[model samples]
Target: MNSARCILSENDCKIFQTITDEWHNSINIEECFLTWESKSKCKAQSKTSFLHTLCFHIRGLGLRWGEVLLLTLNGKFDVITLLETGKFCKSTITNAFPDYNIFYQKGGNPHGGVLILIKQYIRVSRIQRDV
Candidate 1:
């Protein structure tokens, strides 16, 4: 489900942890996220830079929503693809994330699903793929 796959580097692991830890102490804001990660190698300095996207294989997004929220907020992700989200039905998770629009595809298996989140400000139209 995560077609736009970008591998996280070793340093990204450190930054991810740091951001997650720091988010706990910071106030939550709906608009304008801190781009601390952008200063690192994580972001491309070019003006042609695209949206910040991350594909995370969180086994279950149910219990760890707070953590997910913190990470996404601190990382300043514009789009996120949650892979292997277990046992969630389509439309059951709508409005789960207030600022982001949700799109999901459930699989036959009890423990496999795909959840895509795009920021509300990003104008996106769904397109079908032959895959």
Candidate 2:
């Protein structure tokens, strides 16, 4: 059997080694997260009204534009539940990046954290077009 050799640059190799050496480091990461509720403000637009509160909460969490836009009523409810339980999902990077206004125009793979939100918008547009 032939084995394929993986090639990496010195810096890449160093990074790989660091991660491998610290594979158990994740346990310490949660504590490092900046709790969104604890922060006073972010640069994103703030809508203080009740209907807009959910959107504000998502933005406060540092969720990307796509993820925020994709959020639904149910998703917002889930966020509340998780907060009550002191459990939250780990965030991950996704392919799409939003413009400055925090709106997703189009194109990109959905990271796990952003998938449900993205699906919410896609479903709406599909329905609109079908009408």
Candidate 3:
């Protein structure tokens, strides 16, 4: 019984460790983005190799898809994060930006949501969290 309990505890530790590592990476990415944004002041500068990420508070994507499209093209971004996107129809965003893979989370309120778009060539998986 003790051995079984130890094994379960060990497994839980490993799972939590993985989650911590992912969160750390997320923080690092956010830091990098903020640093870049501060230096560039929201200029459309293309990155060389690796990932070029851009995030925006689009408020409502349905109203600004065209503007986002232009930024994606001009900046040559590999990942784009849109905040407060309101309600999303996956097909609408997907059809508009066929080059990206969409991942989004709707908020409890009508005026809140987040949408992430990763370039098709880059591999990504959405992490699920239980409420």
Candidate 4:
């Protein structure tokens, strides 16, 4: 088991320790190289005049909102988009993120929904489309 332990820097260990139990269990440590690389990419992008966005296809957010919120807050993303929310009403989505401006389009199929969450500081306008 000792040999299987992941070798991480002190700071990386600290960051890893901060991950929520749900996320920790859901993600395998060995498969997370992309996550670390994305962090570096985000840092590099931040130095430039580029905008950062975090998008996820959760499949279902009914029982996994906590885990998703943990990642979103920790990532400090400018925008968050979620798919397959399994939410039929707008109130449910609004209640999840009171601080965010939520826009969603519910599909006719059960357990199918799309949501976009934008932070309060960012200005956004709703565009009406003729369907």
Of candidate 4, the 10-residue stretch with the lowest lDDT total is: 1-10
Clashing pairs in 3: none
Lowest-scoring 10 consecutive residues by lDDT in candidate 2? 78-87
TM-score of candidate 4 on Cα atoms, chains taken together: 0.54
Per-model C-alpha lDDT, please? 0.70, 0.33, 0.79, 0.73
Best by lDDT: 3
TM-score of each candidate structure, all chains considered together: 0.51, 0.17, 0.57, 0.54
Whole-structure CA lDDT of model 1? 0.70
Best-to-worst TM-score order: 3, 4, 1, 2
lDDT of 3 by residue, 44-87 (tens): 44443477999999878778878887987789788899998987
Q: Model 4: per-residue lDDT, tens digit, 1-131? A: 22223687666666566554435664676546566677789999888864568788887787677778688768867688888877645776677667789888886666688888888888998899998
Error of 2 at 79 (Å): 50
Ranking by lDDT: 3, 4, 1, 2
Off by over 4 Å in 4: 1-47, 88-96
Clashes of 1: 0
lDDT of 1 by residue, 25-113 (tens): 55663211454544443545554557899888787877556766678768977899988787654454565567788878886576578
Q: State each candidate's clash count.
A: 0, 1, 0, 0
